[model samples]
Target: MSSRGTDVEDAVDSEVAAPARGTGTRRRVGYVAGLFGLLLLLLLGAVVVLVAQGSIAIPIGEVLRVLTGQDAQSQLSRTIVLDARLPKVVAGLLAGAALAVGGAQMQTLFRNPLADPFVLGVSSGAILGASIVILGTSGVGWLSGLGLVSQLGVTGAAVAGAAGVLLIALGIARRVGDPVVVLVVGVMLGYLAGAVVDMLVYYTDPDRLQALATFTRGSVRNVTWNELQVIAVSCAVVLVLSVFLAQPLNALLLGDRYAGSLGVNVRRVHFLSLASVAVLSGITTAYCGAIAFVGLAAPHLARGLLRTADHRVVLPASALIGAVIVLVAEYVAGGNGLTKTSLPLNSVTAFVGAPVILWVLLSGRARRQAG
Candidate 1:
């Protein structure tokens, strides 16, 4: 064929290929979007059920009435639904979403599907950080009595602690380049942080120990509206910030070298991602205690359900899935009056998280070095 005719044929082929590529991309996006819609519905249903079926067992109709500012059957039902169940539900929602998003980011940043804030001891660091302030200030009667100030102080401390551990883990991963080694280092750091917390607890008075005990076990039931305000505000800020991280993180998924070639600052992306993980994990730990496995399992579940590692889809989907998991866990752990004695959140999350960890190990993902 003449050179001009060959060029014309190539142009036609290129035009045809473009539409097929666009169609495939649109199909994937649609699938993920549909999954997200379903997840949102599940989360909504879980919230309604939690609010209506808690210890007092308010009817769904009554709960809806109180929520919409309409009158319930009785003043007592209104008080129970509005005052008590609402805050716990809000806390669970925010905390779950925060952890899941953080996990998605961490998994991407570390390039390990198994990496999660809680699994790597980031939560332990937060607990230790909050313990210092809670223990140190307990002796000062006036300081301990300063409610909001004291709460913020502890929250701030927890954030700092989580950041410290995350930085250390990232540093080690940078040096070692081995995901397994870095994972071990994170566990050691967590144990070290926990050891320090134990020392502080030993010196703390009996009165203080009771509070620490409750905080360590992880429960959303005790979260008051004031505390929920702090968790909700902080989580909302970090979650929004995470939206910006999503594109960079998806770039990093290819490998630091490829991401850098694509104009991504690998170091800067790593820093910001780990920082977000720290904030999400720290604040949740400070308020809800070190609820486990939500961080470790939710991202994996997001990926599995959506069948893609695209952070744009995975991040939000993970958040909704995490919220559902935590709310359901709370309900099963006696929030719904299934049992008189409440169980810790970790107890429930472990069932989901442990198997995921095992799958990662067995699947050879953990054998690869960090990217």
Candidate 2:
């Protein structure tokens, strides 16, 4: 062949050998779209099912009415649906979403699919902080005498406690650089926090103890509009922070060394990730009381379902999945269809999360290091 003809043939062969980059980009976009669509459907379904199944048994019509701000048939009914049930549902939805998103970040940061917002003993620390406030102070003139500022002090303490554990755990993770080692470190921290809580409870006055114990078991029933406001402000702030965090977290998934090579500050990512986890876990634990395993399992489920480890995909997917799991859990825990007495939120979650724990361990994912 002539030289010009040979060059032309080689160019044709190269074009035929590999597809255009645009095709791969289009495929990724489609996959993301499908996962997002699934997430939306699951979120909507969860809202409907949970709203329909609460204790007072509001019909789906009334539930919709309340949600839409339409009048109910009776004043008591209106109050129940609008004021009581609505807040509980909203709280559950936010709590679930926040925990799941936080969990996803934690898993990526620690490089352990099993790592959750709670795993670093942050939740336990919050529980301890809240317990001290509730059990040691509520019975005194303290709660009655204190203004909203003082009341927030307790919640603030819970947040600080959670943040403290997160700082410590992240420090260890940075120093150690092994996911399993960090996981063990987190477990020990949690146990230590629990032991401290136990000692405090033993020393605490009996009247205060009763009120404080609820902080450990988790409950959605105590949510009033006042407390909701605090949760609202905090959740809003943290969630926005989370949205900005997605890209950095995704970079980290490539490993600290690779992320650093890409001009991503590994230390800064760790700092932000831990801070986000602290706020996310702290606020949820403060209100919900150490709800277990939602964080640990939801991200795994989201990743497995979407078949992608990218935080940009997994973060939002996990949030949607988390909301669904908790809403379903709330119905199960709330004595819908199965029994009269409502089961604890922790109990229902354990049933869902326990198997995930087993899988992480048995599948060797839990034992693997991020490095």
Candidate 3:
């Protein structure tokens, strides 16, 4: 063949052998879409089961009907599902999603598999902020009697405390330039926050102690619609912000220096990501009482199931998985009538969370990542 003809043939072969980049992109998009659809279905099924299993024991069909504003089996069924169970179910869903998203961000930003809102002591800071208000104002009225104003006050306090701790952690992280050192620092900070909270509770009036204890232990059963509005608004806004963070966080997975080289603005991204975590974790801790390991476990589970750490898939998947975990825990922890006495959410969450922690450490993911 002539030289020009041979070059033309080679070019044609190359073009035939390689897939178009757009086609690969579309295939990935479709796979992610299917994954999200499956997760949404699982979350919906969980919500139905949780709503149906409470003291009233409505059927899933009745629960769905009531939710859709259609007729239930009876007016009483409607009242039970709508007026009573709906708020709690919704609270669990929002709080779970919020915490899980926060944890996923934390893990990526810190580049530590075990990083989470609770581990960083953000929740403890939130609890401390809440305890100060609750215990400080005990003479005025118990938390149950304090109206919307007090609710808002407590929520504000929690957010402030969480943000404060987050900033401190990030500052230290910047100084040390070591994820392991920063993780230890965060744990110590959490201990300090916990100590402060304990001391505040110790001096608190007996009447206020029970309420404070309940808040610390965590429960969604008592979250009223009024409370849900605060949680829903704050969590929804922050969750949307987290969506924008996905791309920046994905870059960060390659390490800060690499991410910075890619124009990720490492410092700014860290600030924004940590801020989102503060809002999500703080508000959730305020309303639901440090619901525990959902934040830590859900993100890891999402990554494991999806087999990717790409924030786009992991973030939403973590949210759905977190929602399912919380709903399931609520059901098992006496959100259902299967047990006479209700258990705190942490009781069940610890089951999922503790194992994951051990696995991460034992498998050397943490050591390898930190190294």
Alpha carbon lDDT of each predicted model: 0.85, 0.77, 0.86
Ranking of all candidate structures by their lDDT, best first? 3, 1, 2
Q: Count the backbone clashes (under 3 Å) in each candidate.
A: 0, 0, 0
Q: With candidate 3 superimposed using the best TM-score fit, by how many Å does residue 117's alpha carbon deviate from the native?
A: 0.5
Candidate 3: misplaced stretches above 4 Å? Answer: 1-16, 19-30, 139-142, 365-371
Backbone-clash count (model 3): 0
Better of 2 and 3 by TM-score: 3
Q: Residues 137-181, candidate 1: write the lDDT tens digits.
A: 744431234478888998999999999999988888889889888
Model 2: per-residue Cα lDDT over 1-371, one tens digit each = 69999999999987875676667778878988988898788777767666666556767777777678787766776777667765766777788888888888888887886788677677887777766666656554323434577668777778888888888888898799888899899899999989988898788777666556555767676677776787878887887788888888888888888989889988887887778777777777776677888888888898888788877778878888888888778877872645667777888898989998898787774456542
RMSD of each: 3.4, 3.3, 2.8
Q: Once superposed on the true structure, which residue ranges of model 2 sit more than 4 Å away at CA?
A: 2-28, 139-147, 335-338, 365-371
TM-score winner: 3
Q: How does residue 352 of candidate 3 score in lDDT?
A: 90
Question: Model 1, poorest ten-residue lDDT window?
Answer: 137-146
Q: Which structure is stronger by TM-score: 1 or 3?
A: 3
